[model samples]
Target: MIRIETPLTDETVERLRAGDRVLISGVIYTARDAAHKRMVEALQRGEPPPFDLKGQIIYYVGPTPPKPGQVIGSAGPTTAIRMDKYVEPLLKLGLKGMIGKGYRSPQVKELLVKYKAVYFAAVGGVAVLLAKAIKSSEVIAYEDLGTEAIRRLIVEDFPVIVANDIYGGDIFEEGRRRFARIDL
Candidate 1:
Protein backbone atom coordinates (compact mmCIF):
# COMPACT_ATOMS: atom_id res chain seq x y z
CA MET A 1 0.00 0.00 0.00
CA ILE A 2 1.76 3.11 -1.28
CA ARG A 3 1.10 6.24 0.76
CA ILE A 4 1.36 9.75 -0.68
CA GLU A 5 1.47 13.01 1.23
CA THR A 6 0.31 16.38 -0.03
CA PRO A 7 2.52 19.09 -1.50
CA LEU A 8 3.54 15.94 -3.36
CA THR A 9 7.26 15.60 -3.04
CA ASP A 10 9.20 14.72 -6.21
CA GLU A 11 9.95 11.37 -4.64
CA THR A 12 6.25 10.77 -4.15
CA VAL A 13 5.15 11.86 -7.63
CA GLU A 14 7.86 9.82 -9.22
CA ARG A 15 6.83 6.84 -7.17
CA LEU A 16 3.28 7.28 -8.51
CA ARG A 17 3.72 5.86 -12.00
CA ALA A 18 0.91 4.56 -14.15
CA GLY A 19 -0.94 1.55 -12.70
CA ASP A 20 0.08 2.15 -9.11
CA ARG A 21 -2.51 1.71 -6.37
CA VAL A 22 -1.95 4.40 -3.78
CA LEU A 23 -3.30 5.49 -0.46
CA ILE A 24 -2.91 9.26 -0.36
CA SER A 25 -2.55 11.21 2.87
CA GLY A 26 -2.19 14.90 3.73
CA VAL A 27 -4.08 17.88 2.32
CA ILE A 28 -6.06 17.78 -0.93
CA TYR A 29 -8.30 20.49 -2.29
CA THR A 30 -11.72 19.85 -3.78
CA ALA A 31 -12.77 21.72 -6.92
CA ARG A 32 -15.50 20.66 -9.30
CA ASP A 33 -16.67 22.24 -12.58
CA ALA A 34 -17.85 25.58 -11.23
CA ALA A 35 -14.99 26.10 -8.86
CA HIS A 36 -12.51 25.24 -11.60
CA LYS A 37 -13.92 27.90 -13.87
CA ARG A 38 -13.64 30.50 -11.15
CA MET A 39 -10.10 29.44 -10.34
CA VAL A 40 -9.03 29.71 -13.98
CA GLU A 41 -10.69 33.09 -14.30
CA ALA A 42 -8.87 34.30 -11.24
CA LEU A 43 -5.64 33.12 -12.76
CA GLN A 44 -6.44 34.83 -16.05
CA ARG A 45 -7.06 38.12 -14.22
CA GLY A 46 -3.64 37.80 -12.55
CA GLU A 47 -5.18 37.45 -9.11
CA PRO A 48 -3.60 35.03 -6.71
CA PRO A 49 -5.73 31.99 -6.09
CA PRO A 50 -6.73 31.17 -2.53
CA PHE A 51 -4.43 28.16 -2.56
CA ASP A 52 -1.04 27.46 -4.04
CA LEU A 53 -0.75 24.91 -6.88
CA LYS A 54 2.87 23.94 -6.75
CA GLY A 55 3.22 20.30 -5.77
CA GLN A 56 -0.49 20.13 -5.06
CA ILE A 57 -3.09 17.54 -5.97
CA ILE A 58 -6.64 18.64 -6.75
CA TYR A 59 -9.44 16.22 -6.00
CA TYR A 60 -12.53 16.51 -8.16
CA VAL A 61 -15.53 16.03 -5.93
CA GLY A 62 -18.64 17.57 -4.37
CA PRO A 63 -19.05 15.61 -1.18
CA THR A 64 -22.12 15.17 0.98
CA PRO A 65 -22.53 16.91 4.35
CA PRO A 66 -20.64 15.29 7.17
CA LYS A 67 -22.26 14.02 10.33
CA PRO A 68 -21.01 15.28 13.68
CA GLY A 69 -17.46 14.26 14.57
CA GLN A 70 -16.66 13.43 10.95
CA VAL A 71 -14.12 15.44 9.04
CA ILE A 72 -16.11 15.20 5.83
CA GLY A 73 -19.11 13.38 4.46
CA SER A 74 -19.14 10.76 1.75
CA ALA A 75 -16.29 11.92 -0.49
CA GLY A 76 -15.71 10.38 -3.90
CA PRO A 77 -14.27 11.12 -7.29
CA THR A 78 -16.29 12.92 -9.95
CA THR A 79 -15.83 12.65 -13.70
CA ALA A 80 -12.62 14.39 -14.73
CA ILE A 81 -13.23 15.18 -18.42
CA ARG A 82 -15.18 18.30 -17.52
CA MET A 83 -12.10 19.90 -16.00
CA ASP A 84 -9.77 19.31 -18.96
CA LYS A 85 -9.79 22.90 -20.17
CA TYR A 86 -8.61 24.19 -16.81
CA VAL A 87 -5.89 21.64 -16.07
CA GLU A 88 -3.18 22.61 -18.52
CA PRO A 89 -2.88 26.22 -17.48
CA LEU A 90 -3.01 25.10 -13.88
CA LEU A 91 -0.28 22.57 -14.68
CA LYS A 92 1.74 25.37 -16.19
CA LEU A 93 1.29 27.17 -12.92
CA GLY A 94 2.95 24.19 -11.20
CA LEU A 95 -0.05 22.00 -10.49
CA LYS A 96 1.52 18.54 -10.36
CA GLY A 97 -1.43 16.22 -10.02
CA MET A 98 -5.21 15.63 -9.98
CA ILE A 99 -7.48 12.96 -8.47
CA GLY A 100 -10.73 11.99 -10.15
CA LYS A 101 -12.47 9.27 -12.14
CA GLY A 102 -12.98 8.58 -15.87
CA TYR A 103 -10.99 9.41 -18.98
CA ARG A 104 -9.24 12.66 -19.88
CA SER A 105 -8.79 14.31 -23.29
CA PRO A 106 -5.77 14.45 -25.55
CA GLN A 107 -5.04 18.00 -24.44
CA VAL A 108 -4.99 16.92 -20.82
CA LYS A 109 -2.93 13.86 -21.68
CA GLU A 110 -0.46 16.04 -23.58
CA LEU A 111 -0.21 18.42 -20.68
CA LEU A 112 0.47 15.56 -18.32
CA VAL A 113 3.32 14.41 -20.50
CA LYS A 114 4.68 17.89 -21.03
CA TYR A 115 4.60 18.84 -17.39
CA LYS A 116 5.47 15.50 -15.85
CA ALA A 117 2.13 15.45 -14.08
CA VAL A 118 -0.13 12.55 -13.14
CA TYR A 119 -3.86 11.82 -12.96
CA PHE A 120 -5.07 9.59 -10.16
CA ALA A 121 -8.48 7.91 -10.15
CA ALA A 122 -10.43 7.58 -6.97
CA VAL A 123 -13.12 4.91 -6.99
CA GLY A 124 -16.45 6.33 -8.07
CA GLY A 125 -19.10 6.09 -5.37
CA VAL A 126 -18.04 4.26 -2.19
CA ALA A 127 -18.20 7.66 -0.55
CA VAL A 128 -18.62 6.29 2.92
CA LEU A 129 -15.44 4.35 2.56
CA LEU A 130 -13.68 7.33 1.00
CA ALA A 131 -14.78 9.70 3.74
CA LYS A 132 -13.07 7.47 6.24
CA ALA A 133 -9.77 8.69 4.90
CA ILE A 134 -10.34 12.40 5.34
CA LYS A 135 -9.06 13.65 8.67
CA SER A 136 -10.20 17.27 8.30
CA SER A 137 -11.67 19.71 5.80
CA GLU A 138 -12.29 23.46 5.45
CA VAL A 139 -13.70 25.60 2.70
CA ILE A 140 -10.97 27.75 1.25
CA ALA A 141 -12.64 29.42 -1.73
CA TYR A 142 -15.89 29.96 -3.65
CA GLU A 143 -17.99 29.64 -0.55
CA ASP A 144 -21.04 31.03 -2.31
CA LEU A 145 -21.08 28.00 -4.53
CA GLY A 146 -21.96 25.78 -1.60
CA THR A 147 -20.80 22.15 -1.98
CA GLU A 148 -19.28 23.07 -5.31
CA ALA A 149 -16.98 25.38 -3.41
CA ILE A 150 -13.27 24.64 -3.23
CA ARG A 151 -12.14 23.06 0.02
CA ARG A 152 -8.86 21.94 1.50
CA LEU A 153 -9.04 18.52 3.10
CA ILE A 154 -6.44 16.62 5.02
CA VAL A 155 -6.69 12.89 4.45
CA GLU A 156 -5.13 9.58 5.46
CA ASP A 157 -5.12 6.27 3.54
CA PHE A 158 -7.13 7.76 0.69
CA PRO A 159 -7.24 5.02 -1.93
CA VAL A 160 -6.78 5.55 -5.68
CA ILE A 161 -5.46 4.08 -8.93
CA VAL A 162 -2.89 5.90 -11.00
CA ALA A 163 -4.72 6.28 -14.32
CA ASN A 164 -2.29 8.47 -16.18
CA ASP A 165 1.35 9.24 -15.56
CA ILE A 166 4.22 11.50 -16.58
CA TYR A 167 5.44 9.10 -19.25
CA GLY A 168 2.04 9.36 -20.96
CA GLY A 169 1.00 5.89 -19.79
CA ASP A 170 -2.73 5.28 -19.33
CA ILE A 171 -4.05 2.42 -17.28
CA PHE A 172 -7.76 2.78 -17.98
CA GLU A 173 -7.46 2.06 -21.69
CA GLU A 174 -5.07 -0.78 -21.21
CA GLY A 175 -6.99 -2.25 -18.33
CA ARG A 176 -10.27 -2.05 -20.23
CA ARG A 177 -8.98 -3.94 -23.23
CA ARG A 178 -7.06 -6.42 -21.15
CA PHE A 179 -10.15 -7.43 -19.26
CA ALA A 180 -12.75 -7.16 -22.04
CA ARG A 181 -14.11 -10.52 -23.19
CA ILE A 182 -13.55 -11.01 -26.89
CA ASP A 183 -15.30 -13.74 -28.89
CA LEU A 184 -13.20 -14.28 -31.94
Candidate 2:
Protein backbone atom coordinates (compact mmCIF):
# COMPACT_ATOMS: atom_id res chain seq x y z
CA MET A 1 0.00 0.00 0.00
CA ILE A 2 1.31 3.45 -0.88
CA ARG A 3 1.53 5.92 1.99
CA ILE A 4 0.99 9.64 1.53
CA GLU A 5 0.78 12.62 3.83
CA THR A 6 -1.79 15.41 3.99
CA PRO A 7 -1.09 18.90 2.57
CA LEU A 8 -0.26 17.06 -0.64
CA THR A 9 2.20 18.62 -3.05
CA ASP A 10 1.74 18.82 -6.80
CA GLU A 11 4.38 16.17 -7.29
CA THR A 12 2.62 13.85 -4.90
CA VAL A 13 -0.78 14.35 -6.55
CA GLU A 14 0.69 13.89 -10.00
CA ARG A 15 2.31 10.65 -8.95
CA LEU A 16 -0.96 9.13 -7.79
CA ARG A 17 -3.09 7.22 -10.32
CA ALA A 18 -6.65 6.02 -10.22
CA GLY A 19 -7.04 2.68 -8.39
CA ASP A 20 -3.99 3.25 -6.24
CA ARG A 21 -4.48 2.34 -2.59
CA VAL A 22 -3.16 4.99 -0.27
CA LEU A 23 -2.85 5.53 3.45
CA ILE A 24 -2.81 9.22 4.29
CA SER A 25 -1.27 10.67 7.42
CA GLY A 26 -1.29 14.14 8.98
CA VAL A 27 -3.99 16.80 8.98
CA ILE A 28 -7.18 16.76 6.91
CA TYR A 29 -10.31 18.86 7.07
CA THR A 30 -13.90 17.63 7.18
CA ALA A 31 -16.82 19.37 5.49
CA ARG A 32 -20.07 18.41 3.85
CA ASP A 33 -22.75 20.32 1.94
CA ALA A 34 -23.64 23.03 4.46
CA ALA A 35 -20.07 23.92 5.37
CA HIS A 36 -19.10 23.91 1.73
CA LYS A 37 -21.80 26.41 0.88
CA ARG A 38 -20.70 28.71 3.68
CA MET A 39 -17.07 28.49 2.59
CA VAL A 40 -17.94 29.35 -1.00
CA GLU A 41 -20.03 32.25 0.21
CA ALA A 42 -17.16 33.50 2.31
CA LEU A 43 -14.86 33.34 -0.70
CA GLN A 44 -17.37 35.23 -2.84
CA ARG A 45 -17.49 37.96 -0.22
CA GLY A 46 -13.67 38.29 -0.29
CA GLU A 47 -13.38 36.83 3.18
CA PRO A 48 -10.77 34.24 4.03
CA PRO A 49 -11.86 30.65 4.58
CA PRO A 50 -11.93 29.38 8.14
CA PHE A 51 -8.91 27.29 7.22
CA ASP A 52 -6.29 27.77 4.55
CA LEU A 53 -7.04 25.97 1.29
CA LYS A 54 -3.54 25.65 -0.04
CA GLY A 55 -2.47 22.03 -0.42
CA GLN A 56 -5.14 20.83 1.96
CA ILE A 57 -7.28 17.71 1.84
CA ILE A 58 -11.01 17.90 2.60
CA TYR A 59 -12.95 14.80 3.54
CA TYR A 60 -16.63 14.85 2.66
CA VAL A 61 -18.07 13.61 5.92
CA GLY A 62 -20.56 14.49 8.63
CA PRO A 63 -19.53 12.28 11.51
CA THR A 64 -21.70 11.13 14.40
CA PRO A 65 -20.99 12.20 17.99
CA PRO A 66 -18.19 10.30 19.65
CA LYS A 67 -18.92 7.57 22.16
CA PRO A 68 -16.53 8.09 25.11
CA GLY A 69 -12.80 8.81 25.02
CA GLN A 70 -12.73 8.89 21.25
CA VAL A 71 -11.19 11.66 19.19
CA ILE A 72 -13.93 11.50 16.60
CA GLY A 73 -17.16 9.63 16.06
CA SER A 74 -18.26 7.33 13.26
CA ALA A 75 -16.47 9.03 10.35
CA GLY A 76 -17.55 7.80 6.96
CA PRO A 77 -17.23 9.34 3.53
CA THR A 78 -20.23 11.13 2.09
CA THR A 79 -21.34 11.20 -1.52
CA ALA A 80 -18.95 13.43 -3.47
CA ILE A 81 -21.05 14.44 -6.49
CA ARG A 82 -23.15 16.67 -4.26
CA MET A 83 -20.18 18.98 -3.79
CA ASP A 84 -19.44 19.38 -7.49
CA LYS A 85 -20.66 22.98 -7.63
CA TYR A 86 -18.25 24.06 -4.88
CA VAL A 87 -15.21 22.09 -6.07
CA GLU A 88 -13.86 24.30 -8.82
CA PRO A 89 -13.51 27.35 -6.63
CA LEU A 90 -11.74 25.34 -3.94
CA LEU A 91 -9.47 23.77 -6.54
CA LYS A 92 -8.57 27.23 -7.82
CA LEU A 93 -7.37 27.99 -4.31
CA GLY A 94 -4.87 25.10 -4.45
CA LEU A 95 -6.82 22.40 -2.63
CA LYS A 96 -4.90 19.23 -3.47
CA GLY A 97 -6.94 16.26 -2.43
CA MET A 98 -10.51 15.16 -1.61
CA ILE A 99 -11.87 12.06 0.13
CA GLY A 100 -15.36 10.72 -0.32
CA LYS A 101 -17.41 8.03 -2.03
CA GLY A 102 -18.85 7.55 -5.55
CA TYR A 103 -18.15 9.14 -8.90
CA ARG A 104 -17.84 12.87 -9.51
CA SER A 105 -19.36 14.89 -12.34
CA PRO A 106 -17.50 15.18 -15.63
CA GLN A 107 -16.77 18.85 -15.00
CA VAL A 108 -15.34 18.08 -11.59
CA LYS A 109 -13.22 15.29 -13.07
CA GLU A 110 -11.91 17.71 -15.68
CA LEU A 111 -11.06 20.24 -13.03
CA LEU A 112 -9.27 17.58 -11.04
CA VAL A 113 -6.86 17.12 -13.94
CA LYS A 114 -6.65 20.83 -14.61
CA TYR A 115 -5.85 21.62 -10.99
CA LYS A 116 -3.42 18.74 -10.42
CA ALA A 117 -5.51 17.27 -7.65
CA VAL A 118 -6.83 13.82 -6.86
CA TYR A 119 -10.02 12.38 -5.40
CA PHE A 120 -10.00 9.47 -2.99
CA ALA A 121 -12.73 7.07 -1.89
CA ALA A 122 -13.07 5.64 1.54
CA VAL A 123 -15.34 2.63 1.73
CA GLY A 124 -18.86 3.60 2.70
CA GLY A 125 -20.56 2.16 5.84
CA VAL A 126 -17.30 1.79 7.70
CA ALA A 127 -17.61 4.83 9.91
CA VAL A 128 -16.64 3.29 13.16
CA LEU A 129 -13.52 1.76 11.69
CA LEU A 130 -12.62 5.02 9.98
CA ALA A 131 -12.86 7.07 13.15
CA LYS A 132 -10.07 5.08 14.68
CA ALA A 133 -7.61 6.74 12.36
CA ILE A 134 -8.46 10.23 13.55
CA LYS A 135 -6.05 11.37 16.23
CA SER A 136 -7.84 14.63 17.03
CA SER A 137 -10.71 16.76 15.78
CA GLU A 138 -11.82 20.35 16.37
CA VAL A 139 -14.53 22.44 14.80
CA ILE A 140 -13.08 25.22 12.72
CA ALA A 141 -16.27 26.81 11.40
CA TYR A 142 -20.03 26.48 10.91
CA GLU A 143 -20.65 25.04 14.33
CA ASP A 144 -24.39 25.49 13.93
CA LEU A 145 -24.27 22.86 11.22
CA GLY A 146 -23.49 20.22 13.87
CA THR A 147 -22.04 17.11 12.21
CA GLU A 148 -21.79 19.16 9.02
CA ALA A 149 -19.42 21.60 10.69
CA ILE A 150 -15.98 22.15 9.20
CA ARG A 151 -13.46 20.34 11.34
CA ARG A 152 -9.71 20.15 11.42
CA LEU A 153 -8.68 16.52 11.87
CA ILE A 154 -5.31 15.07 12.58
CA VAL A 155 -5.25 11.58 11.14
CA GLU A 156 -2.70 8.81 10.99
CA ASP A 157 -2.70 6.18 8.23
CA PHE A 158 -6.22 6.95 7.15
CA PRO A 159 -7.00 4.58 4.29
CA VAL A 160 -8.44 5.52 0.91
CA ILE A 161 -8.34 4.70 -2.80
CA VAL A 162 -7.55 7.06 -5.63
CA ALA A 163 -10.92 7.40 -7.31
CA ASN A 164 -9.92 10.13 -9.74
CA ASP A 165 -6.35 10.99 -10.62
CA ILE A 166 -4.72 14.09 -12.02
CA TYR A 167 -4.23 12.29 -15.33
CA GLY A 168 -8.01 12.18 -15.81
CA GLY A 169 -8.34 8.54 -14.92
CA ASP A 170 -11.47 7.40 -13.06
CA ILE A 171 -11.88 4.18 -11.13
CA PHE A 172 -15.65 4.05 -11.57
CA GLU A 173 -15.44 3.98 -15.35
CA GLU A 174 -12.73 1.37 -15.24
CA GLY A 175 -14.78 -0.77 -12.93
CA ARG A 176 -17.77 -0.51 -15.24
CA ARG A 177 -15.69 -1.50 -18.23
CA ARG A 178 -14.23 -4.44 -16.38
CA PHE A 179 -17.67 -5.64 -15.41
CA ALA A 180 -18.90 -5.28 -18.98
CA ARG A 181 -16.04 -7.42 -20.19
CA ILE A 182 -17.13 -10.26 -17.94
CA ASP A 183 -19.17 -12.72 -20.03
CA LEU A 184 -22.14 -12.74 -17.70
Candidate 3:
Protein backbone atom coordinates (compact mmCIF):
# COMPACT_ATOMS: atom_id res chain seq x y z
CA MET A 1 0.00 0.00 0.00
CA ILE A 2 1.19 3.49 -0.82
CA ARG A 3 1.01 6.20 1.83
CA ILE A 4 0.52 9.81 0.84
CA GLU A 5 0.19 13.07 2.73
CA THR A 6 -1.81 16.11 1.69
CA PRO A 7 -0.50 19.19 -0.04
CA LEU A 8 0.91 16.79 -2.59
CA THR A 9 3.70 17.94 -4.83
CA ASP A 10 3.90 17.33 -8.57
CA GLU A 11 6.59 14.71 -7.96
CA THR A 12 4.39 12.80 -5.52
CA VAL A 13 1.34 12.95 -7.78
CA GLU A 14 3.35 11.79 -10.75
CA ARG A 15 4.48 8.73 -8.84
CA LEU A 16 0.91 7.48 -8.32
CA ARG A 17 -0.88 5.15 -10.75
CA ALA A 18 -4.42 3.90 -11.27
CA GLY A 19 -5.46 0.97 -9.03
CA ASP A 20 -2.83 1.73 -6.38
CA ARG A 21 -4.14 1.39 -2.84
CA VAL A 22 -3.30 4.47 -0.85
CA LEU A 23 -3.44 5.52 2.76
CA ILE A 24 -3.84 9.27 2.79
CA SER A 25 -3.06 11.28 5.88
CA GLY A 26 -3.03 14.97 6.74
CA VAL A 27 -5.36 17.78 5.70
CA ILE A 28 -8.13 17.61 3.11
CA TYR A 29 -11.13 19.83 2.44
CA THR A 30 -14.77 18.84 2.02
CA ALA A 31 -17.15 20.27 -0.58
CA ARG A 32 -20.00 19.07 -2.72
CA ASP A 33 -22.11 20.60 -5.49
CA ALA A 34 -23.33 23.74 -3.75
CA ALA A 35 -19.95 24.68 -2.37
CA HIS A 36 -18.29 24.00 -5.70
CA LYS A 37 -20.72 26.29 -7.49
CA ARG A 38 -19.97 29.08 -5.06
CA MET A 39 -16.25 28.60 -5.54
CA VAL A 40 -16.55 28.73 -9.29
CA GLU A 41 -18.66 31.84 -9.04
CA ALA A 42 -16.07 33.47 -6.81
CA LEU A 43 -13.40 32.76 -9.35
CA GLN A 44 -15.53 34.17 -12.16
CA ARG A 45 -15.85 37.38 -10.17
CA GLY A 46 -12.08 37.53 -9.69
CA GLU A 47 -12.39 36.76 -6.00
CA PRO A 48 -10.08 34.38 -4.21
CA PRO A 49 -11.25 30.98 -2.97
CA PRO A 50 -11.98 30.41 0.70
CA PHE A 51 -8.81 28.35 1.01
CA ASP A 52 -5.61 28.31 -0.96
CA LEU A 53 -5.63 25.77 -3.77
CA LYS A 54 -1.94 25.03 -3.90
CA GLY A 55 -1.38 21.29 -3.58
CA GLN A 56 -4.69 20.69 -1.82
CA ILE A 57 -7.13 17.79 -1.88
CA ILE A 58 -10.92 18.12 -1.94
CA TYR A 59 -13.22 15.33 -0.81
CA TYR A 60 -16.67 15.33 -2.37
CA VAL A 61 -18.83 14.61 0.62
CA GLY A 62 -21.86 15.97 2.41
CA PRO A 63 -21.60 14.18 5.72
CA THR A 64 -24.21 13.48 8.33
CA PRO A 65 -24.12 15.56 11.50
CA PRO A 66 -21.67 14.19 13.96
CA LYS A 67 -23.01 12.32 16.95
CA PRO A 68 -21.78 13.32 20.38
CA GLY A 69 -18.01 12.75 20.86
CA GLN A 70 -17.26 12.41 17.19
CA VAL A 71 -15.12 14.56 14.91
CA ILE A 72 -17.26 13.85 11.84
CA GLY A 73 -20.16 11.61 10.81
CA SER A 74 -20.78 9.23 7.93
CA ALA A 75 -18.23 10.90 5.73
CA GLY A 76 -18.45 8.90 2.55
CA PRO A 77 -17.66 10.05 -0.94
CA THR A 78 -20.36 11.54 -3.18
CA THR A 79 -20.55 10.92 -6.93
CA ALA A 80 -17.41 12.49 -8.38
CA ILE A 81 -19.00 13.24 -11.75
CA ARG A 82 -21.26 15.80 -10.11
CA MET A 83 -18.28 18.03 -9.50
CA ASP A 84 -16.76 17.61 -12.94
CA LYS A 85 -17.53 21.15 -14.11
CA TYR A 86 -15.64 22.76 -11.25
CA VAL A 87 -12.66 20.46 -11.42
CA GLU A 88 -10.65 21.88 -14.31
CA PRO A 89 -10.64 25.39 -12.90
CA LEU A 90 -9.46 24.13 -9.54
CA LEU A 91 -6.81 21.95 -11.12
CA LYS A 92 -5.47 24.99 -12.91
CA LEU A 93 -5.10 26.63 -9.52
CA GLY A 94 -2.70 23.88 -8.34
CA LEU A 95 -5.18 21.55 -6.77
CA LYS A 96 -3.39 18.20 -6.89
CA GLY A 97 -5.71 15.52 -5.59
CA MET A 98 -9.40 14.64 -5.22
CA ILE A 99 -11.09 11.87 -3.19
CA GLY A 100 -14.53 10.66 -4.11
CA LYS A 101 -16.22 7.77 -5.93
CA GLY A 102 -17.08 6.69 -9.50
CA TYR A 103 -15.87 7.74 -12.90
CA ARG A 104 -15.06 11.28 -13.89
CA SER A 105 -15.91 12.76 -17.28
CA PRO A 106 -13.45 12.39 -20.14
CA GLN A 107 -12.85 16.14 -20.05
CA VAL A 108 -12.00 15.94 -16.38
CA LYS A 109 -9.79 12.93 -17.02
CA GLU A 110 -7.88 14.83 -19.67
CA LEU A 111 -7.44 17.75 -17.31
CA LEU A 112 -6.08 15.40 -14.67
CA VAL A 113 -3.34 14.41 -17.08
CA LYS A 114 -2.74 17.95 -18.28
CA TYR A 115 -2.30 19.19 -14.74
CA LYS A 116 -0.48 16.16 -13.36
CA ALA A 117 -3.18 15.53 -10.79
CA VAL A 118 -4.83 12.34 -9.51
CA TYR A 119 -8.31 11.25 -8.44
CA PHE A 120 -8.84 8.84 -5.57
CA ALA A 121 -11.96 6.81 -4.88
CA ALA A 122 -13.26 6.13 -1.40
CA VAL A 123 -15.65 3.26 -0.92
CA GLY A 124 -19.31 4.18 -0.88
CA GLY A 125 -21.76 3.09 1.88
CA VAL A 126 -18.85 2.90 4.32
CA ALA A 127 -19.10 6.36 5.80
CA VAL A 128 -18.97 5.18 9.39
CA LEU A 129 -15.76 3.31 8.73
CA LEU A 130 -14.34 6.29 6.88
CA ALA A 131 -15.15 8.74 9.67
CA LYS A 132 -12.74 6.95 11.96
CA ALA A 133 -9.85 8.36 10.00
CA ILE A 134 -10.89 11.97 10.53
CA LYS A 135 -9.05 13.38 13.51
CA SER A 136 -10.64 16.85 13.51
CA SER A 137 -12.97 19.02 11.46
CA GLU A 138 -13.84 22.70 11.27
CA VAL A 139 -16.04 24.60 8.88
CA ILE A 140 -13.99 27.12 6.94
CA ALA A 141 -16.54 28.45 4.47
CA TYR A 142 -20.22 28.44 3.40
CA GLU A 143 -21.55 27.16 6.67
CA ASP A 144 -25.00 28.19 5.53
CA LEU A 145 -24.95 25.23 3.21
CA GLY A 146 -25.29 22.90 6.19
CA THR A 147 -23.78 19.48 5.50
CA GLU A 148 -22.52 20.79 2.18
CA ALA A 149 -20.44 23.42 3.95
CA ILE A 150 -16.76 23.53 3.18
CA ARG A 151 -14.69 22.22 6.03
CA ARG A 152 -11.07 21.45 6.75
CA LEU A 153 -10.35 17.93 7.86
CA ILE A 154 -7.29 16.41 9.42
CA VAL A 155 -7.15 12.73 8.61
CA GLU A 156 -4.88 9.88 9.60
CA ASP A 157 -4.31 6.84 7.42
CA PHE A 158 -7.48 7.42 5.45
CA PRO A 159 -7.92 4.71 2.85
CA VAL A 160 -8.57 5.30 -0.85
CA ILE A 161 -7.63 3.96 -4.30
CA VAL A 162 -6.19 5.90 -7.17
CA ALA A 163 -9.04 5.93 -9.70
CA ASN A 164 -7.44 8.14 -12.28
CA ASP A 165 -3.70 8.81 -12.37
CA ILE A 166 -1.52 11.52 -13.83
CA TYR A 167 -0.66 9.61 -16.95
CA GLY A 168 -4.37 9.10 -17.88
CA GLY A 169 -4.89 5.66 -16.37
CA ASP A 170 -8.52 5.10 -15.30
CA ILE A 171 -9.45 2.32 -12.91
CA PHE A 172 -13.16 2.39 -13.75
CA GLU A 173 -12.46 1.63 -17.38
CA GLU A 174 -9.85 -0.97 -16.53
CA GLY A 175 -12.14 -2.62 -14.01
CA ARG A 176 -14.99 -2.78 -16.52
CA ARG A 177 -12.73 -4.36 -19.11
CA ARG A 178 -11.38 -6.85 -16.62
CA PHE A 179 -14.81 -7.89 -15.41
CA ALA A 180 -16.16 -8.22 -18.92
CA ARG A 181 -13.84 -11.16 -19.52
CA ILE A 182 -15.08 -13.08 -16.47
CA ASP A 183 -16.66 -16.38 -17.59
CA LEU A 184 -19.18 -16.90 -14.86
Model 1 stretches astray by more than 4 angstroms: 180-184
Q: Give me the displacement of residue 28 in model 2, in angstroms.
A: 0.2
What is the alpha-carbon lDDT for the whole of candidate 2? Answer: 0.94
> How far off is residue 70 in model 2, in Å?
1.1
The alpha-carbon RMSD values of the candidates against the true structure, listed in the order shown, are 1.5, 0.6, 0.6
Number of backbone clashes in candidate 2: 0
Off by over 4 Å in 2: none
* Candidate 2 C-alpha lDDT tens digits along 37-97: 9999999999988988999999999999988888888999999999999998899999999
Clashes of each: 0, 0, 0
- Looking at model 2, report the run of 10 residues with the lowest lDDT sum: 64-73
Weakest ten-residue segment in model 1 by summed lDDT: 8-17
Clashes of 1: 0
RMSD of 3: 0.6
Better of 1 and 2 by TM-score: 2
